[model samples]
Target: MIQASAGRDRIGRTARLGRLRVTKAGQALSEGVLVAVAVVAGVVVAVVAPAGIAVPAAHGAAAVSLLVRARTVAGRVGLRLTLSAISVAAGGLHYVLVDQMGAARHAAGVFPPVVRVLACVGIAACLGGAVAAMVMAATENGTTLIRLRRLLDGWLIAGSLFTVGWVLLLHRADRGGDGSASFLGLGRVVADILVFGLLVALRFCLPHAQRTATTVAVLALAALAAGDVLRILPSEPGAWDGIPLAAAGSLVGLFLVAVAPWLPGGVSVVGFNQRMMPVIGVVAAFVPVVFCALAIAAHTVAGGPIDTVMSALAGSVLLALGVRQGVIHADHLRITHESVVREDHYRTLVDRTSDVITIVSPDERVLYVSPAALWVYGYRPEDLVGARLPLYTHPDDRETLMQAVQILRQDAESDIRGPGRRVSCRVQGADGSWRHVESTINHHPDGLIFISRDVSERVAQQVQLEHLAFHDALTDLPNRALFADRVAHALRKRTTDEAPPVVLFMDLDGFKEVNDSAGHAAGDTVLRHAARRLRASVRAGDTVARLGGDEFAALLEWEAGAPPSSAKEVAERILTALTQPYPIGTMKAEVSASIGMAVAVPGITSDQLLHQADLAMYAAKAAGKGRIRLHHAEPPHAHRGTPNG
Candidate 1:
């Protein structure tokens, strides 16, 4: 019964996992279908109804489809789709009304005031919808929108100044003309500027991920701008060479807007072609210059003061635009120069530093090595560049270094910001000598930065200090502190079957006489000789220490099943060596040692063992110098110097 239940549980888990995969695939397919339908519809309309009423009708249908599809999307995306649908619908309505008005004007030679008012209303609604779309985009993506807006503002300000200059210059010439036509012309120019500016702004505001939609929208706007320019420049609007261009532009713009809702969302399209911005500014500045030059030419040939005055005003606008462009260019040059100077200054600082700095790629190859490498590691920068990090590391240390690299690489891959890691290892120099170095490694986007400093001198000094802390200065032997520490360590590791370790305490007999007769130097010589003798008498695993003036100690580890007599043999050997004479400089000295031996037992502390051994040494000194005494827990047995001697 349990096995059957387990099999069913396994099946359920597998089914759940499969369901998640299927859902992801289904969502992708749905989006692909929607995109394909939108693109096909746009292509069909563009090819078949380039300048027909069918264009706007097709757009209106697409807009309704978009509004219905928007219900399936959620959150900000749905809101964007809904706004885009409204914009497309308004554009479709404008196209339909304009086409109807054009037909009426063609049939009747003029449109009724009511029809004109309705046409105006449609244009106003279209403009309102475009403005609303821009506002929604800016609110949704604030940073990208603001940047694009700033760039557009610069171009607009320059163009507006030139336009104002021309208007002022041409005002006097238009005084004798029909005032209504002149007003209408001025209003048309202003409206064209506003519409063209909005389209350009929308082009930049669209995200880059919406490539298909953005491309189509840009083409639509460019066609519309070209059509507006044609209408404005030509003297006879109805008889212009490209009369169908304006209608075609309207068709394309409305159709693309209707298709926009079906396009993908959540793709960031914020990148602008920075390289083109300066070219755009230059072109904008040149427009006014060209116009002003034409005005000057006209004045020179025609010889009219009014024409010259108009030329002068136009020339003023061009002069302002050119000056603005020049100012912006000059600012850019200054900033570039300052940036270069700052970079050079920091480069010089890095070169002069004492520590070697290196940049290593993610694959562990060295990308860059600072000039300080020559001084620190006896290697030129070129010698280390492109080399793997483990090449110069000690063979024993390479494994540890690689492990650290793996950890840091994992952290980077996981998007975790870890603290800088520090490692100390041996780095081989050019002269075949290894120098200890301490390196601090920090992670960067392109690679890791290693700031390594030579620490050989520091490491040597640390070793010296540590030795001094635990050893005798004159004899260079472990002191009482270290000796006691070893005893404690052995006690902690002791087991029931193991024989306890032994402690031997020895004191030089009559050592003060050598110091008084031959000076303190001879006394130091005697102590050094005794230390060497004590070390030689013990096993290699034993510890020997100098316990201050005329005093020394030894610790011996006894293996399991070793007899107790072994301790006595070591004590007797130490006594014989210490009793022999020591040569000090030009003089010879003599000293005998009183030795005491104590064996460690369970539940006995290091201090207690040392005290017992000390007591035995005192007893040996009293019983007569140059004797070995074994310590016991009872007073009578503790005084035994040598058994049966």
Candidate 2:
């Protein structure tokens, strides 16, 4: 009856896992299809129509797509999409008018002002939407104070970039009398720059899944900004051919924005505001100082006096930077205070113990033991006294205790015990448990007096903490730090004749899908299984580690004259092991490993070796997963197979 019930449970779990994998795979396929369709549409438009006609059509299509996306999603993301649609639509109309105006120079004077106004409005809408989206996304679940600080950080970066651009590009003595037209053109350039900066800021504020789309969106803004900047730069008549470039850039930007919402969203940046905001503040504070110094030097060398307006703008930026620093300092103080309080609380919870005193003979036998032996070593004083030190000392540490005894016995004076010497080693308790024991030895006429303390609990706690630092909590595998340290040690011990060590960087395929469909708990189960397989697949002396998330790494050290093919064999085994079905409850989940191996050279550093492996692993992923690639100076060699096992 129990066996049948277990069988049913196993079958049910497998079914659940299969369902989740299929669902995620289907969603991925759908996204790929949509992207393919968008690409084909773009290529067809570009080939069939003229540049001017193609640019506006692209913008119009993108605007419609964004609008549809806005309707599907809600909250800040939707709001940004909606605003972006409007702004893109406006840009398309502006481009159409500009194209028409260019054809009919008779209305050039009138259309210039109208075109400029429309362009400014569109740019303003886009910039505002990007800023609003960033603020809303960043502060959605934050406190009032956090929101305020994020807002401050956003403005500080924006303001600093604006000030730098103005001082370096726009505030010039030569352009003082360039009229309102030139001024408006420069203002447009500055605003476009601001829009690009804000879009970049918004990228970090988004979740990791949304970041790829956000990056595409940022590239779109960069294209548009580049086109706009080119139009206003001083060029000889007919020498500046910006119109075609502008048109092409506009089409690319519009298409990217339109398709961005189609991509999937993943986990948002956790504690982004808390961790990244301060870094942004520090970087923003330095921008004006660096730019202003360069601007001043350039102006002075050109025999131009610094503009008062520019100086005042720089001053204002400095003032804001000062306020930002003050806020960061206050935050640091609060965190430090909380840490101190927590430390005090932990200290209070720790128990105190009195040291154990004993008398040892020159022959390393315990002549007398304190009553504390029962509490310290789980033995009565009578049981411990007159026993040899080797009986209670750990096998591995007995030599250390013996060396200390020799030093104490060989002291020059009988009254002294080798300059107040102390030695620490592991001691065995009566119950067959080991305790970390520290002993201080002193000389006496009859024998040597020893004061020992059992610090097993304290030492155990410290060791556990260190283990946690170096190993992954989920899988108990060595983490990135420990792996890197081992790799460095291996590299240092390499000889000229021996085959160099190999570093394998592995990234799991379809693991994210498992997380997305079955939840993080299921993903963790998959990771634990993967970790075990990885450990078993590698040689006993080789090191295997979880480098975080779905990525893992390994170090393989070879004996002299060992062929590089040895690394390949190990990698294949790992690939086979990891590709096996994982049992999560009753469900069977599957994921494949993409492994990249980099062989070390005489002078190659650990980081470089790791990087090469990373690149090779990415190549394996790109070639198609469930494969291995070996890194070389020229090109990576790839291997793919299906093992019968």
Give RMSD to native, each candidate: 12.6, 31.7
**How would you encode candidate 2's per-residue C-alpha lDDT over 1-645 as one tens digit per residue?**
634654564465456656866887897787667655655555455555676778777878888988898887776667767766776676566556544434543554676667656655654555555555555555665445455555555555556666556654564412533344344445545545555555555455555545656566666676665555544443411222333454445555667668776665422331254444435544643664577567667767989766776677667667766776677677677768878998877445422336777888777788877677778888888987788766578887777677656556655232233454687889878888888998987786656777788888889999999999999999999999999999999989888888889999999999998899888999999999999989899989999999999999999999988887899999999999999988878888888889998888767777778888888898888788889988766322333322222
Best by lDDT: 2
- What candidate 2 gets wrong by more than 4 Å, as runs, is 1-51, 94-123, 143-149, 152-157, 167-188, 205-210, 234-243, 264-273, 276-292, 341-645
lDDT of candidate 1 over 1-645, digit per residue (tens): 634654564465456556856875886677556545654554555456644566567657757866776687766556655665665566556555554554454455445446555656655655565555544544454444244443444335334433444434245324523333333333323333444444444454444445445445445454544443433344433423533554444444555555544555332232333323444534543554565566556655766455553555555555555655565566567557868999999899899998998989999998899999999999999988889878689998886676666666765765555677787889999999999999888898777888899999999999999999999999999989999999899888988788788888999987999989988878888888888898898889999999899899999888889887888888888888888888887667778888888877667888888888887888788888799887876432233333321
How many clashes in each candidate?
A: 2, 5
Q: How far does residue 87 in candidate 1 sit from its true spot (Å)?
A: 24
The TM-score obtained by model 2 is 0.44
